[model samples]
Target: MGLWATPTLAVLPSEQLKDPALEARARAVSAGLRCVVCQNQSIDDSDAPLAHDLRVLVRERIVAGDTDAQATQYLVDRYGHYVLLKPPFETATWLLWLGPALVLAGGAGGIVLWLRRRPTAVPALAADEEAEVARLLGDNR
Candidate 1:
């Protein structure tokens, strides 16, 4: 099998944490960041150049004594809410989160209205036709 090629992280080697806890924190931070080149993938899973750079940035932040929330806020501040998979509940995002349920409710209401307006099936034929059938059967008894 051919050797797997790892993408080069852009930060200097001195920026990397020597301690295991900091390394874990760095990994956690990296996993939250979306790869700009691959919008659907987080930095941890993407091999794109931007993702490599983001991985390095995450490590750098951790080494610089930034907490996970602080590092995430730093990225979010730069990139805007589009980078987040789960955006916060705010006026701008309320429609994005609740639009589907509202649409479903509207559809259900339309169906109910249509059912109420539809005509009922009416029974056809006259009294003479009913008598003929009774004669054919000898009598109603």
Candidate 2:
């Protein structure tokens, strides 16, 4: 352990790729990665420690001759599809992809059924009843 010893510290974006192209690629990949700690923020946008770690890992993989797809798949393999901001529309994510539309369609169908089954409007007062009531309670004689 000399003064030159590389400290076991987390990697930063500036400490990562030398090539701007690779950095751009990492940025693109990071943009699609969800921050597991900050569930609503992408790793590229999040300041969470785990997000920084993930961003560094992505840059490392890209620098180490892995394609963007390969690096992304590596993360996906480790974290499951939950790490992805947009999961594929498959069996696992079908509910997420279609739940809203299905709800809307069901609501529309329910409204149609209700409209069809509605009873016809009844008069507030029938013609004969209106006349009799007016006669009984005459206006100002």
Candidate 3:
């Protein structure tokens, strides 16, 4: 009844099973996989053929005795890390993880530089205005 559960199995007939445990594992793994075609969606929620293929591939690898990490690693290797819902923090991913902070720092530095270069406001008084102000304020002796 929730947004995540529509009871729709997009797998092939041969992929359906009565084993709840395998199905559960499949769901668990699939839910953490990103759909290459639909970047924002997990394979479980995607109806794309590539998503279905990835789902089947995951089930196949799991049934073949690959651990969850192994299966995920296989997908990551095959898809070049783009298939991972959560990319690992490594040298290759450092920029992706730190991009926002870097951008913010750069923006702050630019603002500071701009402020430093900005001209100071100087009040230019006309001859008459200057005399009036001097008279009202009592000119310094």
- Ranking according to TM-score, highest score first: 2, 3, 1
TM-score of 3: 0.59
Score residue 80 of candidate 3 by CA lDDT.
80
TM-score versus the correct structure, for each prediction = 0.58, 0.61, 0.59
> In candidate 1, what are the lDDT values of residues 65-106, reduced to their tens digit?
889988888889989877665677899999988999999999
For candidate 3, the per-residue lDDT at 77 reads: 88
Model 3: per-residue Cα lDDT over 1-141, one tens digit each: 543575665655576445778777888888889999999999977889999889899888888888888988898887887787888889999999999999999999999999989987877999999889889889572
Query: By the TM-score metric, which is better: model 2 or model 3?
Result: 2
Worst 10 residues of 1 by lDDT: 1-10
* Best candidate according to TM-score: 2
Candidate 1: list runs displaced more than 4 Å: 1-25, 112-141
Pick out the ten consecutive residues of candidate 3 with the lowest summed lDDT.
Answer: 1-10
Q: What lDDT tens digits, residue by residue, belong to model 2 across residues 4-109?
A: 4744333453655788798889888988888999888888877788888899889889988999999999999999989889887998789989999999999999
Among residues 3 or more apart in sequence or in different chains, the pairs in candidate 1 whose N, CA or C atoms overlap within 3 Å are: none
Error of 1 at 85 (Å): 3.0
